[model samples]
Target chain A: MDTEPALFSILRQGQVLVASVHTALDDSQLLRLQRDLVGRVGTDRARGIIIDVAALDVLDSFGSKTLRDIAEIARLRGALTVIVGIQPDVAQAMVELGIGTGAVATALDLEEGMAHLAAALGPAWTP
Target chain B: MPGLTYDAGVGAAVVDSGADGPPEPSAAELHLLVTRVVRARVGNHPAAEDLVQETVARVLAASDRIDGGIEAYAVTTARNVIATMWRDEARFQRYQPRMVDLDEPDAPDMGVLAGEDQVAVRRALESLSVQERSLLLAHEVDGTSLATLAAREGTTAGALGAQLRRLRARMRAEYLIVASHREPPTERCRPVLVAVALRDQRRWREAGVDDHLAGCDFCADVAGPLLESSQQDSGRVAIDVAKDHDVVEARVAVRRLAADLGFDRSDVTLVATVVSEIARNIVKFAERGRMTFEPARSRPGIRIVARDRGPGIEDVELAMRDGYTTYGGLGLGLPGARRIMDEFDIESVPGRGTTITMTRYRKDTR
Candidate 1:
């Protein structure tokens, strides 16, 4: 109802489609965005989803677990998810909360994350 | 927002008596708002109620500003009142009595005082050297610090300081190592001991001992007990392993005792492995066995003595050999246990029983 509480933008690097999430992406919003990205890419070609959480000040257990779940689901859908901008305190809190972030590939910033995703997806993965 | 009533009798009071002004929040609304405010402030219900009542009284005095959103206004007012109450409570606690005399001579307070005395003794001994410990004992206990220590040890102020520093560092290190092994120390102790040991170790080797002693408090607390236990004779543990369950229990018990002795997890694992093999042998060959966990006198290690009343092995030399086993597998238990442990001894009679005594020194001790 509130436009799903987050902003989503799609960018293209010569047919390589990258869905960039630029707001506080919670569980439901993440799921919705994933579905929308999968629909846009049509599953025939590989796609990359880059979740930018730079604006987030707090990352509780539910948020971290949801991100992990999103990564797993994206892999199953033949799309790779790169989570970026995890702050040090948020990482520490996640460890203290016993939230396992082992599944997802994390990067310092969105640019690096995109680079990593691009490298993992290879040159032919471009749409 | 305009249907409000003013009660001039209750010290400049304002009440939202207007029919449209949210119907003047009911008793239930007031109770819920106050309860939330109190819980957030004091963390206890009864104390929260007292603070809430005070806030309500304050609100009643200045109720003239009662507007449309009365619930939000009441919550803000309650928060301010609780904040003021907390400050006053903290101020009162600051000047509270440190000691209370309850007229009884021998009570729990005396035990508290004894605890305080122990702390004081530890604090005093914390900065003394082994020489200083001996010196203090000689001076205070034997009344010989003035001229006798000076004559016997050639005591000068500078020499005394150096000796005291060394002594203090050793005791501190030993205390710290023992403390660190049990549980991580508090934030305050960790930094202080770290600074002291780091600075002291730069000058002396004994001072460096503090860094190694940084973990287990159980070992630190029982250092004296361990020494006393080692000094005493005729204190041997007798183990009887007559059943399979006994073997398992003995292995678990030895592992636990190793932990109680403040052995690190790796050492505990090794000892547990050796004890398991020995225990299994007793069950398979001897039918029954017993094991004892004792402190070794000559060495800084734990001695595990296991015995079984079964058909004893005919060849002691063959059993000690690395690949010699009648019960299959790699047959590395006896030899492996011997190699891993510091000392190992096995004694078996042809048809009576066998006793194997093994000792594993603590890591720091080794």
Candidate 2:
């Protein structure tokens, strides 16, 4: 078995939240994490979620699609989604794969991603 | 004397005013003129407004310098200003979006299934005797043909075939029983492990496996998820060789992957030959370019994407033609790459970039 580390950390400030995914988040892991987060924060309270993946070196079609699905699920649960730390090569690969990054708000880095998430959550909720 | 002096000064100041005051530019005429200037300066309208404003400002400032018709002067000034703006803006925009930091999100790990479900699959497999496991593993994972397996095990093909049939029946019965009581095994749950096993065994040849899979729906179902999982996990491997063309290194890597995938030696040779040609091109023309290997989405094939940001091919169609080379010696870079692979795609934007994708399918080992 491939023993690659798959870790995720969740940070919450009031209603706003940020999830730092620090591994190769495969399809299976993403679904589990999404389910767990939805359960813990109560679909309504999970206002904003930011996936920080600065460490990942690869992002394939399955990976890109999972991000879109996460965004859709988060939206349904009254939360906004933003993805940060997408490497340029991976972005190019995603483009070549013809996968759309439209559903998830993508940022150059985590700080910008957090800012986008905060803004999406509105002025009332500061993070 | 005072009246004559005043008349002389007035006559000196009277410049030849020529034609009736420059034809008044109508609003439509002004808009059309501005639009043309804007388009010329900025390729698109999104940035045209700013260019138009700058043009108007320049025209107003140089009003005194205008010798001829005001409209002509305005148009001339607009074009000059637009040209200057385009040059400056192009440079600025180029500097703003650096190549670094366009990071995308990591692949999400969708919760495939619980650990218990995986345990259930293993337990079900283990329920069979060691011989049964070995037979199934050889047939399903290694993708060894019944004839080959029979030969290896010193048995007849008919006996080996019956063995596979019995093993499949046993596995299906066990899986059904597990599914009835336990969490339904996800499509991904069992196949992922099986794929891992196959990859580990280096049995990627689809030929022997393909034959068995053709008639066996159960085995296909079992292998499908594992194959997908393996592809997802393999990701992409990129090699950057500075000055030397690492043909040997690339060939070795390709061979290793091909061996694991169970590709026929001949097919591997064809792919390796194409890769060598592509590598030569990079060395000869590009000087430096990265060669990448990744799993293809369709079938048990691998994709090789070669990319270079060098002086692109002058004519892609001509370049694809066999023996069409600017710098001699059996020019088969494009055509050869096309001939060996199941699918070949090439995209090149002159002076910008070139990307070539080649896919080689694994021989089904049934």
Candidate 3:
């Protein structure tokens, strides 16, 4: 309830949709984003999804679960999901979560996330 | 013991003379009220009847002998009688002669003294062996007959009396040691002090202490309120966990605190993640709880404590094992926490609450 809806802005760039999370989201807001992102990956024919979490101070269990769920659902729609900008500490914490990012692709930042997305799209893919 | 003396005629005067002296309750009502008050205090005490009679006698006698009217005077007399009864009952139980100070042996009252004597006495008592403690207390404090105790133990009275005398001597030596506040004479005290300085009580026995810290000032100090102030460098941070956003806040705060406490970048994240998972668990399962972390005293690390009054886990050991998630699939919060923390402890009472205490030491790096 404390989180504003869609506080993180999403933008389209070619076949990749980049969603930069700028603030914290409560449970329902996170659920809403998961639904919206997975829907767009199909309807918009997006080949990849890049999620930048540089501004997020935490990626808690629920947050991590949402990321995993988004990735899983987006993959079913023929889109690849790449999480980016996980801080050094956040990365260490995710390792301790014992799931190792739950099979979701990760990158150091937005550039790396875009690079990973392009590479996962295969040899013929362009930026 | 009051200064006023009762005239035996005052008992006769109190009969039904409602004609005078502040007729608010009338003589019969006043008499009934006084009797009821006395009965409430000394309830079924065999001396209750005599106490009531004496109270009435004092009230009426005070009227002529003292300043106040009988109505107002009667209340004081009744209250004093109740207080005196309790005091006498207490005194009767002890059955000891009046106290005398060591310095002024002639004086009856011991007067007010400091807690040093009490602390010393407690420490000395603590120093005694279990058998000596019970035996000494049985004879001296509990008033159990020493001869009867000797008979029960199949020992002679003279032997028991001699053992009791040695027990007192050992207690006196311990009292002197405690009173002086000097370093304990034994070689073992150093390692115990060193372990305590490390701000970890778990290492107490491991630090070369097989025995003999009983009644030592250091032992009492360890058992005192010393654990709380251990983390004095960065102090402590406490946050309430109630919602998803609160977990985020807790993570950020814990991250900062870990950094402040000299945790490396990766370790900071580990601590922060620990906070995040635990706080989220509080929001998701417990509904509400509190999380606290602090510098490990002046040590190079932090300590964390999370407490929740909720539906506690029925099986704590099962909860700690891998693959035990209240939520289905890939839940590793608690188990992962146990893995990363240097020290982890969890106490839970089913249907009551849960408290998890954990600590992580920092690794030194440039």
Candidate 4:
């Protein structure tokens, strides 16, 4: 049994919702997080979603797919999702594996991810 | 009824399991017990240890009954377990005639209604048809030969023999369900437990077993510790790949190992990515497999081996081409691993499994 600590914490920053992932999550947990983030997008009227993956050590196909799904689903709910903080090695490996960030934007860290979110949210947003 | 009675068979199982199991069977005492009862009956079948562990699990499950003393009850349970294996082999596999029918003199109806949890056994018996129950009793208890029973029923002995074997198999299957103390949520639970008992991960994954095992607590309790054993050597590390988390763990561990072997930071990621891809392939296609890293036998390098008994590739050539996706993967797993590693070799049989061996040597610095 893994620790009962939350897999990822979702923070509401003005019109943006930022999900800071604390650790690597399994397939089912990733799906749950995806659903939760998508649900919160509509409920909170979030304009953008920033999923921070800096703490994750490995980004496999399933992990990449989950990020893509989260971004795509959040987009359908009228929010943009930016995955941030994929490590250099993991990114290189992802490139080797031919896994591109499919339409979902990426940035170096949480700050950059927040910037992407802010840009998507645009002029009137103050955060 | 009011006083305490000793059941040594149950005690033997607990004592035999030993020191949280040091990855080896305890001593020759129980080994010889299993050999004498199981080996002597089946003549050194490969699954002898399985029969022994199965009997142990049954003893733990049936902990209550005050059967024959210590050795006496164990001997009976061992025989029953062997009988189940023997009949299973005879029925499902190609029928090989062992000398039991012709040579043995009036065999001791091995575990029909004897040496099992009586309550569970009776409930299993209740699930059988009246005719089947009567046939079981007449043949097992009364020592009535199948020929005589066939004559009485006006059917050929061969047909009745098939029926009797099917009936017994059904009874054993039902008894296992009853003895385990809970109904399995899915039918795959039996094969999954059999895989756990045999520690065969390939069979464990063929029937949505990973999901089933993850969800079923009772089945997990029965099999968790047994299936978790792995060999650890100072020269190498062996990791069992079953899921996403295992792949991550393999990557992290292999990265450290490669770094320790003087691989540069970039190569460290390469080795880790190779571990990542191969282990992930196992989780996706094989459902379960093993990834092992050993010190190179004949070179100044490291040896990485990933083996899985899953549906192997039909055309290795086509699979090696770039951007060829199968099994919902990104399709670069095999090709990408081949590109980054110094030596890559993949051997696979269509229905059997796949074995990929990759070796990376530290660059010579003059």
What DockQ do the predictions score, one after another?
A: 0.01, 0.01, 0.33, 0.21
TM-score of each: 0.28, 0.31, 0.50, 0.51
Instruction: Rank the models by lDDT, top first.
Output: 4, 3, 2, 1
Model 3 Cα displacement at A55 (Å)? 2.8
- List iRMS for all predictions: 19.6, 15.2, 2.4, 2.5
Better of 3 and 4 by TM-score: 4
- Report the lDDT of model 2 for residue A5: 43
Better of 1 and 4 by lDDT: 4
Worst 10 residues of 3 chain B by lDDT: B208-217
Query: What share of the reference contacts is kept in model 1?
Result: 0.00
Task: Give candidate 2's error at residue B46 in angstroms.
Answer: 99
Q: Which ten residues in a row have the lowest lDDT in candidate 1 chain B?
A: B207-216
Q: Candidate 3: where is the Cα deviation over 4 Å?
A: A1-5, A24-29, A122-127, B1-234
Instruction: Write down the DockQ of candidate 4.
Output: 0.21
lDDT of 1 by residue, B93-183 (tens): 8856645675667876889877766665675575566666777667556766455566677667567655555555455544654443444
Clashing pairs in 4: none
Q: Could you tell me how far off, in angstroms, the CA of residue A105 lies in candidate 2 after the best superposition?
A: 1.3
Regions of candidate 4 where Cα sits further than 4 Å from its true position: A1-5, B1-233, B298-300, B363-366
Mind giving the per-residue lDDT tens digits that candidate 2 earns over B74-158?
Answer: 6777787777866887898898778468776554543345555676688789988998898899889989889898888999999
Say which prediction, candidate 2 or candidate 4, comes out ahead on lDDT.
Answer: 4
Q: After superposition, how far is residue B234 of candidate 3 from its true place, in Å?
A: 7.6
